[model samples]
Target chain A: MKVGFVTPRYGPEIMGGAESAARMLAEHLQARDGVEVEVFTTCALDHLTWKDELPPGVGELNGVRVRRFPSRAGRSAAFYGLDGRLRLAPREASLQEAERWVQLNGPVVPALVDALTRSDLDVVCFYPYLYYPTVRAIGRVPMPAVLHPAAHDEPALYLPVFGRTFASADALCYHTEAERRLVQQVYPETAATPQLVLGLGVATPPPARRPGGEVLGLGDRPYLVSVGRVDEHKGSVMLARFFAAYKERHPGPLALALVGPVAAEVPAHSDVVVTGVLDEQDKRDVVADALVAVSPSALESFSLVVLEAWTLGVPVMVNGTCGPTREHCEHAGGGLWFTSYEEFEVGLERLLADPGLRRTLGQAGRAYVDRHYRWPVLIDRYLAFLEGVLARGKGRRGSSERADQLARGRRAQALA
Target chain B: MVEERLVAEPEGDHAQELVRRVMAEVHQEAARRRVEGGLQASELAELDELFARHAPVGAKGQRLADVLRHVDARSFVDPVVPVASKKAGGSALKRSIRSATQWYVGFVAHQVSQFAAAVSRALHVVDGELQAIHRELELVAPGPAPVLDLAGTHRVDGWWVAPVLAALDGVPGRVLHGGCGDGWLVEALGQRGCDAYGVDPRVDERTSRVDVRAEDVAEHLRGLAPASLGGVVLSGVLDGMAPAQRHQALEAALAALEEGGLLAIQAATPAAWDRPEAPGEVDLAPGRPLRTVGWEALCRRLEVAAEVREGPAGMDLLVLARARGQGAR
Candidate 1:
């Protein structure tokens, strides 16, 4: 079976979470047996400016065919003012205004949408809901359309047009059950659509070498690591302030490493280390050797770093208000959450003092990953769901199911 | 060494232990800080957190009524919509459309408005009556009865288990054993080819062999699908309960059983409570044992087809009742 992905941008170098996840998924699907993959995206790389960098045409990257189209117009500067004014009364905005909001949130790749609508792929998957290609082509595409909303609780999510975007898709792919519930709560009319909480599968990395803290340029002092883009939007500033206060209260060699690509300036403090944009191996090493891996972002729809930390048998701490991160903690029973400074101090102290608790939490978290998020299990579920989608559009697909009754009978007799 | 071994074992629930302990400490500390006006949360956030748990019962019904009132108030169609528009001649076009459709829309809105108001008023009366009954119960009735550990305090025999197995023989649905500590009876029932499970607050899910849930017996029964169970057995839950709580458990058990289902009950006799040296649980229990005659009277009042049997030594009593309906054999 053949599958296609329609994303705003597609590449290995892009660090935007949603687009990076789409690239990874496309690559993984291309590697599988009997499943071909293609990508239809734009020539833009920089999301802030939306300038055309890559040559616009067909190319092959990692065995998947990619087609790039140039934007008719980069987002005009005038749209920002209109966006700020319309967001205040988003729900009451007129149809023309809402569509304009999506256009301004742009790389208005009209050719990409047009080319995808004419493609012969069995099913098409839209990486994210907020884009020009998706908002225009989702309903018009004749084949079954699967929307990977990657939605967050933000102002754009409430714009009246997104309601139509979510409702028009044949099925939805959510990062977490919490994300599914959040989307359903916003668009109650789409509750009946077929959906799957298919969180991105984490590819098992080879054993990470145990490097000391100096690998991240910090000495061999006990440290905690927080991953992802370090910016105000990602809560890096608050984390730095909280760490500064924690260091002042308990003066010691305990260091806090903010390890990722840095967007905003983190306040320079004695105990904090900001290692911006490490290689993948170094990133894994930093997460692997830490006392705890922390996800402080409150607006995440999916935090793959948490699962990556768990895959290496490390516990995590996250903001309690983030639905997806908190759900990972609750489901695995491997982490703690803190909404205030005092709770953070107390929680860190608890995790630091108890070696056995840390070990058990790490073990439990790895077991959760093994049981659900392993690639084989995820691949099977993904294929089966896609098959079901194809079957829904035409007729039933191939028989890939075991006779469950036979398995049940064997289980009963074995127990007997 | 033993504690270290338990802690180091991956099977041990260290995550649950640590989370419970640290959360308890953090809650206590946060509360103290809030009382001292030192909490860092915004006043609005604190107020929201403060009142999250303070809502009275039946507040949901009252909230529904309030929402209906708002809908009713807004149901009227306004013929005089604002003619302000952004496009050239847009204001004039909107005025013309409003004038053309005003009377038709207003006539339909009048009927919808009256219907919404009627629903709002009817809901208001129901909520008021429910609140009154709740207040009356609070004033007149005794507080909920306390549960005592009869399983640890007293010895029970398998005399009733055989009869229960026979009565529930060929039963069509699953069986539940209330107060099934260690789940010995439920396991035995399952071994006999009976689909059986148990509910006991003390049963550890990791160690128990049977499908025993750590929940209150009555609360578990209330969550079951109506007429889903083939049989239900109560042994120690009725040992020390107020009359109201006892009736509540009985009603829940009967409601969960299908037609022609078995309802087995066993309790210690009042004379059996003479053991003042049983445990502090018995000594401090809020209610005492019920007599066998009282059990018979309860069965009679509920119109249940029941048999009252005295244990061989007069130390225990058993009541076996069948939830019989007109169509049931």
Candidate 2:
């Protein structure tokens, strides 16, 4: 079976949440027999500028062919102004204005749409719903499309354009049940399309030594670690404030290590250390030795860092407001949750004080990862889902024919 | 050592010990204030603290706190006596003043007591009436329906039961012929080695021959027990009900069917009613059949595995077999 992946950006240079997930899946799928995988993406590496870093041509990475198309234009100040105006009152944006907003949102590649419309693959999977590559290109394609919306509760998802994109797909695969519920709440018509909650498979890393206590210039002080992009939206500010308050009350020797891309300013504290974007092995090493890994983000489709920490036999603490992460902790029983500073302090204190409890939670978490997230098992489930999709479309004129009919119905309704 | 161990274990003798101590303290305090005729307000306040601090977890502790705070009965009472003396010169004037004051106090107390009793009775009656109204509203008001566009799924035409009955020729069981319009479908099912009975809103001279009754389909289904029927044939019954009603009827039918029992459903397609040769036998006044996509979505929502067959004659047949160990959803 020939498959195509539609993403805003591709390759190892571009490391975003949905991009990484798509890359991992594309690489793993290429290794399987009887399946030929290709990535159709923009030539841009940076989402900020959407500049054509890579030449507009075909390239090969990890044995999978990739076709890159340069974006027609990058994001603009006018777009930002419009964004601010529309977000104040989301429903006020006109249909034509929303269409223009999709273009100005960047990764606007016309050639990619042309390519997608011309090519007929067995299955074409669109990664993430935020980009023009997905929202615009998806509706134009005639092939059987499976959308990995990676949806969250955001204003953009409610746009009429997105509703049209959701109606055009044959099936949708979500990273978590929370994401699926959000989609259902937003687009009730999607119930006609098949859906599956298949999260990205994490590759099992080989056993590695923990980073020495003195290796990162920390002496004998026990500390908690948070690994992700340090941004206000990602709850870095919240974590910093809570940690400071905890320090003031307890006056402990505990330190907090923040590691990842620094998107927001780190609060200046003697005990808080910000390590921006470490290598994969080094990141794993840091996680292995940490007392507890914290996922403070309240808006995650799936927190890869939490799973990665679990794989290293480290228990995690997640924000209770994050549905996906909290659900993981619930299903795995390998972690705890905190909705406020008081809860955070209590959870951190308990985990830090009790080594036995920490070990029990960590072991449970590792067992969960082994049971549900093994790469081969996940790939098999994906194959089975694909099989189901194919069967549902079989003997009918096409799967999208019904979706198109529904799309037309929606159009009529919109006009009415 | 035993007391310490019990204290460590909250469920042990520590609980009984605490209860005994609280009761002893309460009795001692009550006795210490007996000279004042009744337990003082200060004593009750102290007892409240004791109960709150020593209250065990759960309902017993709550009960203890509530009882201690509301205890109002006193052990002692003041005695009253009538006086009559005729020995002194000013005895008549003093006796007259005392008698008038006593009589006035007694009359006011009696009226106040009577008014309190009346107020209490009125309050009780009002509470009872409010509860009755609440219950009535609960029965009258509808529950929230599932938030899906179920409007289009309830209007299918009913003439398509013929093809469905023709397909169920070899099926065997006690068939519940739902919406047995004019008893034709039930009569057909009777010849197929099945005990067929039907319920419909419209029962006439035709239904006199069979065990058919005039009743709403959803209402009849709701009356049956779980796993009571061998099979259910829903023919044109789902087209004329509201979304919630249709969902309830489907749930009832699924629950009523025995394990491995067959469920044969025939509903009008989107175009069934518009056809020039649409079957004019069954009357579908307010409801229309679900469109193709709408029906598929409804089935998906119901989570029932139905083998759908689209007919060329503006109708669709969905044959389902009840799975074993299927419990109420």
Superposed by TM-score, candidate 2 places the C-alpha of residue B205 at a distance from the truth, in angstroms, of: 52
**Least well predicted 10-residue stretch by lDDT in candidate 2 chain B:** B1-10
Inter-residue clash pairs, candidate 1: none
Tell me the TM-score for chain B of model 2: 0.47
- lDDT (0-100) at residue B235 of candidate 1? 74
- Which residue pairs clash in candidate 2? B155-B288, B155-B289, B156-B288, B156-B289
Q: Judged by lDDT, which candidate is best?
A: 1
The Cα error of candidate 1 at residue B89, in Å, is 53
- Top of the candidates by DockQ: 1
Please write out the lDDT profile of model 2 over residues A1-416, one tens digit for every residue: 88899999898977688888999888988899988898999888888888888988988999999999988887765788777777655556776777877888887788898998898677789999888888877766777678999876556766667767777776678787667656765665564244566777776865666562454567777888899989877788668767876787679788888988898886799889888888877787778888999998867888888988888889888876567787677656778776444456657776788787688678777776776677887787777667555544421213345445545544543474
| Per-prediction tally of clashes | 0, 4
Model 2's DockQ? 0.02
TM-score of each: 0.59, 0.59
DockQ of each: 0.06, 0.02
